[model samples]
Target: MVVIAKELLQYEKDYIKYYINFPKIYYKQENDKDYIKNEMIESINELVFEDIMNFMGVVEDSYNISSEEFIHINSITEFQVGYASDNIMSLAIEFSQLAGFYDISYLKGYNYDFKLKKEIILKDLFRESVDYIKILKKYIWVQAKTLLAELQKNEDESLYHIVEDNICLDEENTFYFTSEYLVLPFSSCEIDQEILNLLEFKIPFNKIYHYLSKYAIKNIVKKIVL
Candidate 1:
């Protein structure tokens, strides 16, 4: 087994009352080249810088009109390692922001194949012939309708229709994986916010075992013994 370490780099601007934290990873392997390590670190640095600049632009606009007492901003970044070995790394990074009355969060995941030195996408997990999108969409809509049923049972009738219309699978990129489950995240208002602050639907691997391609099985399921 190879040893890997994750480090958090913190940044704060007291004047704007904002702070940010992001991750940098290090590999403890004799064969690891300096250039590869440098490139990864540089990429992370660039991402962090972009995030900071984007948030600052939003803050600047809000500060122009909002009173100092009413202005408050906070950003929280966190990561979870789903699977890690000598050849593969899968993880998710969650970014949550609270600016005055606005509250938003996002989940981004990366499945990296060390041997190929490339990032994996959703389609890569399934066979080319399989209509993965249609299959995934069916399962997701089932879950959404289940939620709608519960809302109809207890919530007000008028609000139920409004919520139903907004429940949609807008993007296929909002997916990740853990050792046990395939995780999918929903936007804040995409579903009924009254039900959940963050909507993450986790489908167990056993539920979709046969849908996985050979590559996914070898790298993820077999490695995790699931």
Candidate 2:
């Protein structure tokens, strides 16, 4: 049971001035499906507004939560979707924050190694399970130049450094997958792009299918085809 103190949200002298409310973000749920789903909600509830405020030192309140100030929480389920799955292939938790025109993303995940009958702590699944670095290095220059040209055309040359920093792919790079595309999200401010939001690159699965784990390929084909 969640215990709420009488003065939980009261603005007292000793109490925290900045507090974040936990809103229901789960799109679906039920009595039996509250295992992982419940845990995800609990993790988000722990995020404090002061931590973000002190980290970014921007706003004391979340009223101006536009592109300037926002928090995005993302979770990835690698096996059967949601808490319905009896098997836990992998679970990834991601937090993206944008404050005062600066943004950052933090990801933590654990993958169940079916063969080993154990679990592997993965900093990122995309970089570990696939040859993403090789592919990115092969095509980065063209992509970089294309983005540069677009920025120059828009007369936003000041963000060139930020754009350059993101052109590379690594294990620390944040990503999640969909039916057809692998969405790599690089969260940043205007210095990284023109918006204080995530600049996502959606790459087709066919391009990197050969590099995915056999289990992933098998299950994903089923999801996309059937």
Output the number of the TM-score-best candidate.
1
Q: TM-score of model 2 relative to the true fold?
A: 0.46
TM for every model, in the order presented, reads 0.74, 0.46
lDDT, candidate 2, 35-106, per-residue tens: 333443344334433333343333323324444333432211111111112233333333444333354444
Instruction: List candidate 1 stretches off by more than 4 Å.
Output: 1-19, 30-69, 100-102, 149-172, 191-196, 223-226
Please report the candidate that would top lDDT against the real structure: 1
Give the runs in model 2 whose Cα sits over 4 Å from its true position.
Answer: 1-130, 137-144, 156-166, 189-197, 221-226
